[model samples]
Target chain A: MIVAEQKPLDEIRDLIADAGKVLVVGCGTCVTVCFAGGEKEAGILATSLRMASKLNGNAQDVTHLTVQRQCEWEYLDPIEEQIRQAEVVVSLGCGVGVQALAEHFPQAWVVPGLNTSFMGLPTEQGVWEERCAACGSCILGLTGGICPIARCAKQLLNGPCGGSQDGVCEVNAETPCAWQLIYDRLKAHDRLDLLMEIQPPKDWSTSRDGGPRRITREDLRLVAEQVE
Target chain B: MSAADQVPLQIVAYCCHYCAYAAADLAGVLRLRYPGEPKIVELPCTGRLDVLEVLHAFEHGADGVMVAGCLEGDCHFQVGNLNARRRVAMVKDLLNQIGLEPERIEMFNMSSAMASQFAAAAEEMTARVRTLGPNPLREESVS
Candidate 1:
């Protein structure tokens, strides 16, 4: 899931300070699961903003709404009326959700209420840790299912870096050395011979270095000529 | 008249059914006297409490909020009280971040047999909130 944390209340207040009417939009997907931007959070934020503005003697009308998935256009269509009525929108979704809102409503001032942190899963309740960097490549099969790109401090492709000590990363003693984990797992599976293969350098172009990435599936695409 | 002279402080206490709620009942059975300002909302477990519920209490003019659950290591469901404590701490941080006093909300751990402790918690929280005065939102509602 895409994990995010709410921005400081003061910063959020500042963003909507000029608007007379504010709309707080929430995403029901990733941000909801992470407990950052969900229906409950949206309502609480709207209430807090209203109380804060009232205390400042500059009371503003704030509305709260949550879409099924803010990244999808159809889910956002239901809120078009509210978006049109609002002078400013504070999106409690991940970065993608905020951008989607902005793209769908160009005339409305849209701002992010959360700092989209990373693609990860909850390690435990109220705790989320990053797991994937979404590098547009999958190499888990070669590394005993442990992701070096996301877990290693240096994103090393092959063996453990020299900085590792006692199976712990030198960058942070608390972090388990990713390569050490791979080695231990491979040894248990009797596949230690796999480590002897010299792997080539990874292509960085598949990642963000190549600019914004898009995946087009011809099978799923709706051809413009089909409707006619 | 000053703001303090207006409405009495309104505090909400969410008590777990297995412990704190029964403790409150015991306090009443013993004829123990505690502040009457706090309105009790009984729950199956404090673990089920959400951060939004605490925030909404403040939003709806609650001068203070408290969550009373089973003592640490003695939850009826094993970890309900512990989970409640963590969430209460989170709510306190959120309250402080929004310019509200963190003291306005608190969590207490006590067993159903600790009737005196229940009354003490009520008195302690009531006095603390009285000193903190009414919630700022109360003033907004009044004017």
Candidate 2:
């Protein structure tokens, strides 16, 4: 899921300004799962903004609403009424959700309430660690389910860099050596032979190389064109 | 309550429906008196308790808060009580980092049969809040 962290309270105050009506939109899927831009978080942010606005002497009407998935257009259509009424929309979602809202409502100003951190999962309660980079490729098969692109500080595909010390990255001892873990996992699987194959330089074209990539599934195509 | 007569503490209690809420009701039925300063909010399950919600409660006016859930392995929702417990710990760390006392937030696990335990927990939280005084958020509001 997309992981995000709430921006500091003081920063949020600057976004709303003296705007009288503001809509705080939350995503119920990824952000909610990660405990960042979820329905409950939206309510809290709205309430906090309201309290802060009151404190500043100029009251603002802040409404909180959550969509099933803020990245998709279909899920956000339900909030058209609220979005149209507000002077600005404060998105409590990740970067994707904020951009999607901006695209959906071109006239309304959109502000992000959470900092889009990374694609990750909760290792335990309240602890979300990075997991994927969406580099437009999959290398998990050879590395035992962990992606070097996201985990390794240097994104090294081969065995541990010379900087790895005592199973920790030299760049920062706090970070576990990502490649070290990959080497250990592959060794345990008895597939040391896989390491011998020099990984080709990653192709950047399929990723952010050619602007934003769009996928169309011809097999699951909607028949909306037939209605015309 | 007037500032002079006020208890100088405000607490928010998150009571789970299956156990803690029942215990609170039982406390009422048993006529076991406790501090009136603690405000109670009943939830479906402790697992549904979100850290943001707890922070929101505190930001509004709560000086201290407690998550009252079913005993471990006894939650109606299986592991919701445990989830709430974990979140309360995170909330405590976040609170402490922000200069609020870690003692301001707590988690109590008990079965519905433990009505006396609920009262005792309330008393304990109330006393702790008294020591900490009112929430800084409330202090800021008044000043």
Candidate 3:
């Protein structure tokens, strides 16, 4: 799931400073699971903003709304009236949701209330760590399922670097060396020979380096065209 | 009468049913006197308390809010009290951030039989809130 953290209260207050009416929008999917831009968080943020504004003597009419998924058009359509009423829209969604809102309501000024952090999963209660870099490449088959792009301090394709100390990355003592984890897992599976195979440099075209990525399904597109 | 004298400080206490709530009831049976300004809201567990609820209390005129739960490791629902304690700390930090006194909110722990402790907590919270004066929002509403 996509993980995010809310921007500081003061920063959020400043973003919607000039607006008389503000709408705080929350996404119910990825950001909800990570406890960032969920319905509950949206309400708390709205209340906090109101209190902060009141204290600053620039009281604002803050409204709170949560959609199932802000990235989709249909889900956002229901709150069109509220969005129209608000002078500024504060999106408590991930980066994609913020963009979706902006695209859907070009007339309305949309601002992000959260700093979209990473694509990851909760390791434990209240703890989330990045797992997939979404490099548009699949190399997990050769490396025991651990992602070097996301986990390793240096995205080493082959083996542990000289900076790996006692299975910990030298960049930060708290971080476990990704290559070491791959090595241990491969040894347990009796596939240590996989590490001996030298991996070539990863192709950058599939990643963000090329440009904004797009996935087009020709079959789905053709079906939609026929229906139209 | 001044504003403070005219409106008694409003304190909201969210008590867990198994322990803190029972302790308050026991205190009443024992005829122990505590501040009457606090209105008790009983909950299955303090873990059910959300940050919004505490903020709402203050937003709606609560000068102080207290969350009382089972002592550590003695929660009827295992870690409910522990989670509530962490949430209380978070709310306190938020209160401070918003320019409100952190003392306006607190968390306390007690067993079901601790009637004296419950009364003491009530007295302690009431005194703290009284010293802090009414919630600034109340002043805003009055003027």
Candidate 4:
């Protein structure tokens, strides 16, 4: 899921400094689980902004609205009245959600309240580790379940670098060498022979196709004739 | 003396029902006299305390806030006091970001038998807030 963290309070304050009315919008999907930009966070941020504004002698009205998923237009459709009421809209969603709000409501000035960090999952209670680079390709079958593109510091495909020591990556001591883990797993499965088939430079054509990536399913799309 | 001390101060103390609440009750029973600035709001546990609740107190005119929970390792709910401590610390950081005194809010832990500690906490927070003056938000809204 997309993980994000709130921006600095001063930066957020500066973003909405000129506005007399501010609305905080939160996404209920990925950010809710990560405790970044959920309903509770939106409420806290709205309250904090109100208090901070008052303390600074800035008279401002701050309110909040949270949608089930900010990335979808239907989920955001119901809050049009709330969004229209504010001079500035602060989105506590991921980068996609922020852009969705901005795109959906052209009149409202939508500003991001969170710094969209990465696509990762929570490793523990409060720890999150990146797992997928979304490179639009799969190499897990060649390697082990561990992802070298996301887990490895250098994204080494062929084998571990010489700098690895004691199964730990030299790039980051905390990071276990992805290639080492792959080798160990393959050896356990008696498939260590796969490593000998040297992997050349990865095909990144699908990942970076010169522009923003998009996919359209002809089966799901309808034509003007069908709409008529 | 700071200009803050010249104005009236109101400090809200959110006390856990299991420990700090009972401690404050014991202080009252033991005829302990402390500053009356700290208004007590009882909760089931400090873990139940939310950042919005603390901010609500400040927005509604509180000059300072004190979250009183069970002792660090003695929380009846295991990590309730610890959670309350984290929330208190978070609120302090928020206050600092807002140009307010981070010392305006604090977290204290005590058992039911620690009446003296409860009174001392009250006196300490009262003095601290008095030195800091009335909440700037309150001053801003009033003007």
Highest TM-score scorer: 3
Structural similarity to truth (TM-score) of each candidate: 0.92, 0.72, 0.95, 0.94
TM-score of 3: 0.95
Over the stretch A35-89, how does candidate 1's per-residue lDDT look in tens digits?
A: 8999999988998788778768888999899999999999999899999999999
Lowest-sum lDDT 10-residue window in model 4 chain A: A219-228
Model 4, B1-143: lDDT tens digits are 55545566688999999988999999999999998889999999999998988888888889899999998999999999998898888998988887789999999999988999999999999998877777767744332
User: Which one wins by lDDT: 2 or 3?
Assistant: 3
What clash count goes with each model? 0, 0, 0, 1
Look at candidate 2 and give me any clashing residue pairs.
Answer: none
Top candidate on lDDT is 3
| Tens digit of per-residue lDDT, candidate 3, span B1-143 | 65655567789999999999999999999999998978999999998988998998887779999999999999999999999999999998878767789999999999999999999999999988888888877644433
| Model 1, position B134: C-alpha lDDT score | 84
Q: Chain B TM-score of all predictions, in order? A: 0.92, 0.91, 0.92, 0.92
lDDT of candidate 3 over A71-169, digit per residue (tens) = 999999999999999999999999999999999998999999999999998889899999999999989999889999889888889888999999999
Highest DockQ against the true fold, candidate = 4
lDDT of 4 at A63: 95
**lDDT at B72, model 2:** 97
Which residue runs of candidate 2 sit more than 4 Å off their true CA positions?
Answer: A141-145, A209-228, B1-3, B6-143
Give the alpha carbon lDDT tens digit for every residue of B19-123 in model 2: 999999999999999988778899999998988778778767788898899999999999999899888987776665444678899999888889999999999
Where does model 1 sit among the CAPRI classes? medium
